[model samples]
Target chain A: MIRIFKIALRNLLRYKRRTMLTSLLITLGIVLVILFSGLAGSFKAMMIGQITDSSLSQMQIHKKGYVSSIDTMPLNLTLDTNKYQKIEELLSSNTEILAWTPRIKLNAMLSNFTDTTNIRLNAINPEKEILVCPDVGSRMTFDKGREPGTLLNPGEVIIPEKLAKGMNLNIGDPIVLVANNKDGSVNGLNFKVAGVIESILGPQGKEGYMHIKDAQELLRMDEPEVIEIAIRLHNFDRLDKVYAAVSSKLTGFINKKGVPEFEIHTWDELSPFANIAIMIDFMTITMKIIMIAIVLISILNVMMMSVYERIREIGTMSAIGTSPSKIMSLFLAEGLLLGLISAIVGNIIGLGGIFILNIYKISFAFGRQENLLLSPTVNITELLWVSGIVLLIAIFASLQPAYKASRMEPVDALGHV
Target chain B: MALVQIENVSKIYQTGDVEVAALSDINLSIEKSAFVSFVGPSGSGKTTMLNMIGCLDMPTKGKILVDGKQVDTFNRKERAAFRGNVIGFIFQSFNLFPVLTAYENIEYPLVLIKNEPAEKRKDMILDVLDSVGMIDQKNKFPDQLSGGQKQRIAIARALVTQPKLVMADEPTANLDKQSSINVIRLMREMKDKFGTTFIFSTHDPRIMEEAEITHTLVDGKLT
Candidate 1:
């Protein structure tokens, strides 16, 4: 066996130029796959991070059927203070839950004295909201007199940039918000603008922020109520496990009809960007298929040519009593060795390419989100999987040629020119 | 005792619609330790006779017994085993693996067929290399050696396994007169040293004169 391998190695080394060219082609394919995997992986991760940290907060819990009519901001479907107390207890005890914030969602009329428009608002505790959605602060642009990167303060509003621009609002300018409560009564409240926030979805958004106490007062609620609770987990990779655990615990809360009163959703379920993430995964798979095809065709071509050129040699070996199986193994060994060596070189160069990319710190924007820096990274498992695929494809590609060489009749082969 | 017995053996090859006879009713016996040669012109049955005797191919009729075993009855795998354990072969081209050194080429039979231990295989290879008088050229590749040196290595390769018989087809066809004489003498010396039977095919009168017994073939028939 060892002698056969030695011969196989020497044979590959015999045609130095052909071997080097074929190996270079295989190595380049592997390197391209690794680089693409790193870039696509990093891009998908970065975009998910932005969507979750800025607005979605990884996962969310809401009253049953609330998300169906979420666009309507139905105040009648709010989870009252008692229901929230139960949820707060469950969330506090779960080790996976890093932070959670409840918000009062409502739609109301906003007037900048001369101009009036309908606006969607989230009323939150500034301190708690920051823990659940930290990147939300990065979107805020303070108007002159206020502190930068600050969450909404009591009696102050952070209007969307589009709203601010249309209404010509500025910091310290007083505004009125009017809305109809569940009781069919209309009420209004006054506040001053603190800052304008960039919309995470797109520029045409009409969403604004206010302190929770102000929302309760403006809506004439006797006690605190919330339409939704956004949660952040200690590890984002534990999303499914935590989501399942939280869902199981909340399943015990039943309404009069015996159905669960709450629904849970991960960030991907709530964001439109999930489609693009899936598409990135699709593209990565496509790239791997291309890499496999490149390796297959090149190895098959090289092995077939090797057999054709060495027909007389094959005859000599066969006539000297080398078994057909051993002859087959010799050719397979060549391909296996080629793939192994090429994969190693490819991995080294690919990882180095990723390292260089990291050093450059690539930054780009998606939708209304800006300055998203991609740190391309590939894990060991991914590299191993890619290498394993290349090696398997190489063997498969060498099979027909190896078999052909092994089965050739010595008399006929020796007679070949 | 007879090391190889060929009785009324014939070989017919089909080329599309035509059947061509390469050997016909070849009857011969090679004694143990004999130096034998089959001489014929181009398109004669010299090579087909060696092929049938070596178990590289089976005769279309009759029986071929090599070392008292019916080689004509053997399957492909069985024939290979028979060839490996009982017979050795030398080719006109010197047929040394181009990538291997003379030492490695000589070691090929012992390593590939016998799977001999490295320590013992080294002794067997070196012994043949020395008997062929090419021990000094053992480390040189085939291309690095002269025609005589390459043929000497090919003889060494054939004799390394200590088979009962070694068959060479046109063994001196590609060598010069001097190289041809040297290769024939080396084979004779290897046979004398190892007590192995040697049967070679050639049209060269110089190579034919060296064989202790010679059979002439004309157009697939013994003449």
Candidate 2:
């Protein structure tokens, strides 16, 4: 076997130019796969980060029926202060929980004393909200001239940039937001416009933000009431583990109806753009299939030519008592060696391409955000996966020629010029 | 018993619709350790007869026996195994593996086919290399060697397995006169040393003169 391997290697070196060209073709294919994987991986990561950190956190815990009818933001359905405090305590106890924040979702009408528009308002605790999303304040367009914004305060509110512009509102302008209490009585709040913010995620009309106290006061609640609890974990990779641990602990703790009180959801379940991530994965898979085809065709062409050229050599070896299987092995070994060398070369070039890409600080607009950075990377396992696929294709591609050479009659092959 | 037996063997080759008789009604026996040659015109059956005994090409009719076993009954794998164990072939082209160095070419059979032990294989190869006067040229590839040196390496490769029978099909056809004479002399010396039966198919009278027994074929039959 070692003898055949040596012969295979030497034979490859015999046609140095052809061997190098074949290796170059294989290397180029692998490099394309590696580059595509890196770029797609980075894009997916960025999109996930935008959806999770900018709005959803990694996941959310909500009152059992809250998400089902969340668009209505039913003030009658909320966790009272006790259940809220209990969940907050559970979150504080788990080291995996980096931060958590609560919000009272309210469907209301916001007016600049000139025109009124429907809005979905989130009443939040300023400090904790900032901890979960440090960029929340930065995303706000505070001034009528589109200046940076500040976190909300008592008697203050923030409206969407598009809404503020259309309503002709300015910094520190006064607006009235109105809703109905559980008793079906009309309730209204007076507030000064503290900031106007751009929406990083979610649909339009989710346009208003205020202090949690304002929501509790307007809805006429005695205990601090909240409909949603957003959570951030130390590591997003462990989101499922932390979610399971939290869910199991929250189990068996029922509300008055003896039903589980809260349900948890990962950001992927909550985000509208989850399909984009799947599309990226599908695109990557399609790219890999194309790459495999290219490698298979390239290797088949080279190996077929090699087999034809060595017909007499094959006969000579057969007559000298080498088995047909050994002949097949010799060809297979050559193809495998070619793939392996190409992989090594391709990986080096791919990594170098990624490094150069990062150093250049290439940026592009993604969705509504600008200056989105590109950081391409290929992990060892992924590189190995691509290389393994290429080699497997190479082996398959060479099998036909190898079999033909092996099955040739010694008399006929020896007779071949 | 004879080491090789041919019993009424006839070989027919198809050329489109017509059949050509390469060999017909051949019956011959070769004893062990004999230097034998078959000489004929170009289209005669000398090469075909050698091919049958070498297990390279089977006859269209009749049976061939080597060491008392019917060679025609062997399957493809069995034939390959038989060639590896019981015979060696030297070709007119000096058909050395061009990519391999002389030593590696000689060691090819032992390692790949025989699965010989590393230490024993090394000793066997070097011993054969010494006898064939190619020990100094062990690292030289076929293209780097002269015609004489290449033939010597090929002969070493043929003998390295210690085969019971060695078949040469015009082994010296591609060599110069001096190289040709030297190749025949080396084969004669190796036959004496190993006491192995040797067979040659050639048109060279010089080669026929050296054979202990010469059979001539005319129009696909012994004359």
Candidate 3:
């Protein structure tokens, strides 16, 4: 076997130019796969991170009807505070959940005494909200004054830069908020802009940030309460375990009518753009198909040509008592060596691509994001899978021609011109 | 005692319903340690007979025995093993593997047939290289060697396994006169030194004169 391998290697080296050219095609194809994988993987991580960390935590517990009518920011379907506290007790028992925050959602019309615009307002506990989403603090920068920790002594608002710019409002400026409560009464609250922070990506950016106390008072939640819980886990990779823990605790504990009081959702379930994941997978699959075609055609072409040119050598080996299996091994060894070399070299180039991206500092807006930094990642498993597949496919492509050469009659092969 | 026996052997090749007889009713016996030659015109069954004796092809009719083992009875793998162990071949084209150095080509047979150890294989390869006066050219590839040198290495490759018989088909057909004489002379000397039977087919009179016994074939029949 070693002798056959040595001959195979020498045969490949004998056709130096052709070997390099064939290997180059394989290397380039794998490089494309690896680079695309890294970029696509980074997009997934970045997008998921933005949705989970900067806005919604990993999971949410909402009243069943709240999601269906969430666009209008309905207050009627919010979880009852008393019922939620019971679930919260169950959730607190799970060590996987690091932090949790209860929120009051309100839809109100905001005016700066000059112009009015409608907004989705999230009323959150200042202390717990920051712990659930630390990115909020990083995004917080005062256009004029320091943002408050929570509620800012009440009657304070933290608005998106886009909203602040549109309303022509500045820090410390008094604003009026008009609200409609579940009690069929219209009311209004007077408030001052506390700070203007950078917008979060995706739909969360469209919200008007506020304290839970302000929402409770404005919407008259004490009259008829509406509250939902957002939760963060210690390790996001443990999302399934934590989601299941909370879900099991909440499910089967139903009201008299056999209706579950609460519904559980992962961030992916709640976000409308979750289909982006399926799209990324489709893109990777398409890339794989194209890579296989390129590699298969290239290896088949080169190996067939190698067999054609070495017919007499094949005959000589056969005549001198080399077995057909050994002959096949010689040729397949060439194909395998090519694949191994190409895959390894291609991975190096792919990693270099990541390094190049880092050096150039690539940041682009994806969907509603303005400046999303892509940290192109190299998942070793994904890299190995692509390379391994390419190598295997290359051997497959070499199979027919190698078998053909091996099975050739030595008499006829030697007689070949 | 005979080392090779051909018993009423005939080979017929069919191409698209047209049958071509390449060898007909061949009966011959080759004794051990003899220099023998089969002389014939092109397409007169010289190469075909050689192929049969080497167990490279089974006769369509009759039986061929190499060292008393029936060639027709060996399966594909068995035939390959028989060919590897019992018969060696040198060809008209000096068909050395182009990529391998002269030493490596000579060492190849031992690797394939015997799986000989490195030290033993090296010694055997060197012995043949010395016999052919090609020890200094061991590292040169086929393309770098002259035609005579290439055939010398081809002979060395054929002899490396110490087979019962070494079959040569037009071994001197491609060489110049001096190179041809040198290769034939080397084969004869190696046969005498190793006491290995040598049976070659050739039309060259010089090669025919070197053989101790000659069998002539014309139109697929021994004449």
Candidate 4:
């Protein structure tokens, strides 16, 4: 085996140009696969991490009919205090429930003295909301001496940072919020800017949040309406079970439409980017397949030429009593060696390219000024997978030519001119 | 004792429905340690006979026995073992592996047999190289060596395995007259020194003259 491998190695080296070209193709394929897949995976991970940890837990529960349409503004689900207490008690007892927060949401128009913009207002309980949405408190600041725990004075509100800048409103500036009440009455409330919050949840500066009690009185819901419930599980992987448990426990509840129902939506269902991530993953796989095909063809062509060029030598070995299996092993070894060397080369080049790009802080603008999407980073798992794939492809590509070499008749081979 | 016996052997080749009788009803025997040659014109079955004798090809009609083992009945592995242990081959074209140096070419057979220790293989290769007068050119590739030197290395490769029989198919066909004479003389000397049988298929008169026994093939039959 060792002897045959040595001979094969020497034979491959004889055609230096062909060998180098084949290896280069393999290296390029491996590098591209690693680069794109790595970027896609990292980008998806970053997005999910940001979304899940910053605001949305793995799952969310809302009034069943409320989510179907956005036209029902200030829509609220009324939970019986005793029933709500039981649900909270059940959640607290279930080890799988990591955290939970209830919120009241309203779609309203915010108007400064000069400009007005539409926004989604989330009225949250600061203490309970922090467990699920840790980014909320730290993300807000007030120029007027209002801190996170400050009770919401009758006419105080927190505006998003982007909204305040665009509308030319400062902390003490007065604004009007116009919203539709559950009774189909249009209502307007005047409030002072207690704080400014920065959030990527909605458009850069288009959304804000307030204390639940303040929003309830402003939206004219005589009875408190819990608009939505967000829950975090100890293991996100058990999202289906958590959703099932919550749905089973809260099936009959009077919502804004005066119906008895609630709805459950997983985080993946809420985020449209989850589908986009899946599509990108599929695209990465397609690209890898195409690259592997091209590399295999290139390597196969080179190996075929190599086999033909060494016909006489192969014949001599056969005549000297080398078995067909030994001959096959020799060629296979050569292909493996080529693959291994090319993988190393490709990885070095790919990683080097990524490193240079990252070191220079190279970023491409893919969105508006405030929310630019950065190029995805590479990770170790992608590198290892690409290397393994390249090695397999190299071995696969050499099969036909190696078999051809092994099956040649010694007499015919030696007789070649 | 006869080292090789060909019993009424005949070989037929089929090329697109055209039957060609390369060898017909040939019976011959060669004793151990004999330097024998098969001389014939082109297309007269010299190489075909050599191929059969070297276990590279099987006879179509009759049995071939090397050291009392029937060649036709041997399977692929058996044939390979027979070729590796019982016979060595030197080709007319000095078919040294182009990528290998003369030393490596000589070491090739030893590596294939896989029974010898590395030190023993080294000693044997060096000894064979010395015997063939190719020691100085051991590091040179086939393309770098002269025709005479290549043939000498081929001879060294053939003998390094210490086989019972060494088959040379027109071994001196590519060399000049002086080199040819030197190659034949070296084979004769090696045969005497090791008591190893030597067989040749050639049209070279020098080899025919130097051979202890000469068989002539005419129109695929010994005459």
lDDT of 4 by residue, B135-198 (tens): 9999998899889889999989989998889999998988899999999999999999888999
lDDT per residue as tens, model 1, A227-324: 88999999999999999999999999999999999998888787777888899999999999999998999889999999999999999888989888
Q: Which candidate leads the pack in TM-score? A: 1
lDDT of each residue in A1-417, candidate 3, tens digit only = 777777788888898999999889888988888888778878887778877877777788888767767777777777676777787788888988899988888888999988999877878887888788777765655544454554344778877778899899888889998899877788889998887767655556567778778787887766435467888999988998878878887886787888887888888888755789778878988988898998899889999999999898888788778899988989998888888888999999989998898777678987556777877888888888998898899899999999998898887788889
Error of 1 at A390 (Å): 1.1
Give each model's whole-structure lDDT: 0.89, 0.86, 0.85, 0.79
Highest DockQ, which number? 2
Q: What share of the true interface contacts does each candidate keep?
A: 0.71, 0.84, 0.73, 0.61
- In model 1, the runs with Cα more than 4 Å from the true position are A143-150, A202-206
Quote model 3's TM-score.
0.93
What CAPRI-style quality would you assign to candidate 1? medium
TM-score of chain A of each: 0.94, 0.90, 0.90, 0.78
Provide the lowest-lDDT 10-residue window in model 3 chain A.
Answer: A143-152
Off by over 4 Å in 4: A1-5, A46-58, A63-100, A108-119, A127-156, A159-171, A175-190, A195-206, A216-227, A231-266, A369-376
Q: Order the candidates by DockQ, highest first — what do you get?
A: 2, 1, 3, 4
Give the runs in model 3 whose Cα sits over 4 Å from its true position. Answer: A111-117, A138-143, A147-153, A160-166, A197-201, A223-226, A240-249, A367-371
Question: How far out, in Å, is residue B108 in model 1?
Answer: 2.4
TM (B chain), model 1 = 0.97
Best by lDDT: 1
Can you rank all candidates by lDDT, best first? 1, 2, 3, 4
